[model samples]
Target: MSLLLSPFDMAGTPLTNRVVMAPMTRARALDDIPDDHTVLYYRQRASAGLIISEGIPISREGCGYLFNPGLYSDEQALAWRRVTDEVHAKCGRIFAQLWHVGRMSHVSIQPGQAAPVSSVAVVAERSNAYAWVEPGKAGPVQASTPRALSIDEIQRISGDFVSAARRAMDAGFDGIELHGANGYLFEQFINGALNTRDDRYGGSIANRQRFLLDTLDALAATIGAEKVAVRISPFGRLFDMQPYGDEAETWISLAAALSARNLAYVHLSDQLTIGAEAIPQGFASQFRKAFRGTLMAAGGFNRTTAETALAEGELDLIAFGRPFIANPDLVERMRHDWPLAEGDRATFYGVNGAVTRGYTDYPAYQADASL
Candidate 1:
């Protein structure tokens, strides 16, 4: 049997296959609550062995996108329960990705129009944030300069993560995945160029890792270590992330930390986006060596590449982002070697209340395509 099609146990959860639907933000939720559209969007992709939901802000302060969902409130958790129930009814396992945008946000998305908070007071250049100051005016806006978070604020934010994890469990999610990648709050804290703080949460690698480590420990305590997972983009410069000299050491060290905790998996968000550089050829092998747990690699993986990676044992599982977006039945399509549909770029994020157009409206493969 092809390794990609084989069933495996992810931590303690049994998976039907090795295909993972990588998380992508659709921004369909309003008032930080998941709606019916959100439920259908995830239900359509229930065939994936695992589905990681898009970045969910832990609090109002954690929000960056206008319509992105949150987990800090009972209403939001109740709304999410519908999503989790539908996915589970369809025999799918899903994880919520806890997120905070940090300095990559505009004032409009911040509480009371306050400055976005980060490890350092840095302004990301050439970055656009989704801010809805006025209901119809929500689109790409310049990222605002952020204020450095004090130790008290840092502890508060970490507590927010714990609360979100507990809320995820209450909402019936199978597990929770920490959004520690792609130039978000956690990544900002780890990047030396972005984190210029002199306290326990910055400076040396150990210090830089304190926030993430502490959060992970807290989440593990709240939701069990076996159900915790994290995603990281080691050399990512997205959202105006500056290159750091200790990139390799920082990421490898973080991986070791995750391994020591025996989390479900460590998701590597490699250079998979358009025009992004792929991680150096042997880096995955090196990462797998240092981290002795399941490793899921995301970013532009096709069936052949994913199979090869799994067969060679470089990765325990493979995550498909764009493919899953275009083809809800991505696993079945890949299994049958069927040509996949392409998702509309315009609708990838959302257009007015037409979020369902590009989300749940994609059709599955039909026999006519082969003729």
Candidate 2:
């Protein structure tokens, strides 16, 4: 089989191929349960070796976007079950990326009628922010500031995480991907500028990484590390997170901690960006070497560049986001070296399925060629 078509062991779970579907938030789930449209979406993209579902908040407070699903409720799990069943029927393997936007959320989106929590009170400052922002509408905009979470408060959030992971299993998801990247709560704690606590959870890089280590251990104990993966955009600049400290040191320490637990794999996203050179190649490579499990590199991956990363041993698998959005049969296309259709950027986020309508509607190479 070709590299794109080859099957391999992803942390002991045998996958059918190497191409991975990066998680792209469609926000189409109805009432936090995946609807029929959602079911069709995953089933259509079953050709990939693996699929990381859009971020599902562990608790209501963890959510940042409207209509984004939550793993904390039984209804949500049941809704996901239908979607997962369809994907499995098509011979697809899927994982849910557990999420908690922390400070990135607004009070309207927060749970328990309170402010959004984070490592600090700093809000995002974006000169160029993009995302969906209306009734089924999607686009880009600036970020908002969030409240700081106390140490005691963080412990409660940990319990929420465990509950969410269980919900993922209940939804019949094959595994769970902890959203520890992109200036979310976990990243806020890891990054110095966002973390100012002088107590146990702060002080140094090791101290900052402590929260993640403890959380991962607790989570691994619940579902086992083989079924758990953590994604980190070490050099990522999103969610209004402040940049401080030597970029190299923070990520090296962060990777070592995840590796120590022997996770399924570590996904380094920012390294694959188109023009920006935020996450350093050497930094990501260090984690690839430190981590003995599996290494998946995502963000802006196409055929040539993806293959080059794989050939260099920098990654064991490659995940595509926008490509998957436009090319549901991405693995097949890459296998045969077929050209990919560009996604309709205007519909990336919104209701009435405008974005999702064109989302999985693109025809595969073989199907389109016949036409």
Candidate 3:
């Protein structure tokens, strides 16, 4: 049997297989709350060993796009509970991906139409935020210039994450994965070139990594460390993240730091599939050596590559993003060597007059009756 199809234990969580459904933003939550459509969508893809949900904004201020489901309210938590119940009924495990987009946001989508806040007062050049273009209109607009977060505000945001994590547990999530990658809030502070602040949250490598580590510690204190995971993109240039000195050392040091925390896992988000530079060669092994725990990576992986990585001990689990969109029975399809279906790009996001059109309309693979 291929290792990719074998069962594995993630911390104490038992998985039916080693294939994880990587989080992808579908943007179907028109009201910033999970609805029946959200339940159906996840239920259809429950075959994945574990499902990491789409980036759910921790608060309105953390949101970068319109129509994203959030976890900062009781009503939203209640709605997500329904989705989690259904997925659990199918014997599937799901993790809530807590997200904060930081400056990757427009004032139009921000609360009170205020400027987005980040580690510093810089704008992401050539980056776009999915927000309002005009009254009652929505589209991609240039990300707004952000104000630097004060010390008090930074602490407040960390508290917001802890609050969201508690809500995630109430929503019946098996665990919570912090969105620390892709030049988001965490990366905005981690990147030395961008975060030039002369405070405890910036400057030296230790200081730069303080925010994420401190927040992770707080989350672990609130929820068991075994129930917490994080996703990061090393050397990622998404949203105009500039490569900085000590980039390699920064990531490796973080891996070593996280190793001591005894968390669930460290997910590496490779940017190759998203049209950004790929993670440097041999870096996964370097990270694997440092982290010493269940390590997962997602980007341009198929069954063959996944199995190869697992066989070589480079990755304990493989995460599939776009493939899971059209192939709800992705694990079974891979197990039986069935051909996969492609998703429609046009209907990947937004309601488009039919919420289920591209969201839950993908049929499971059926063997030919003639056979």
Best by TM-score: 3
**Candidate with maximal lDDT:** 3
Per residue, candidate 1 scores C-alpha lDDT tens digits across 132-247 of 65666788888899999999999999999999999999999999999998889998999999888988988999999999989989889888999899998878878877777888
lDDT of 2 by residue, 20-139 (tens): 998877776657777877888889898888999998889888877776777888988988999889889988899999998777776545555476787877776652222335545544
For each candidate, the alpha-carbon lDDT, in order, equals 0.88, 0.78, 0.94
The TM-score of predicted model 3 comes to 0.99
Candidate 1: what lDDT?
0.88
lDDT of 2: 0.78
Question: Sort by lDDT, best first: what order?
Answer: 3, 1, 2
Q: Which regions of candidate 3 are displaced past 4 Å?
A: none
Backbone clashes in model 3, listed as residue pairs: none
- The lowest-lDDT stretch of 10 consecutive residues in candidate 1 is 271-280
Order of quality (TM-score): 3, 1, 2
Location of the lowest summed lDDT over 10 successive residues in candidate 2:
127-136
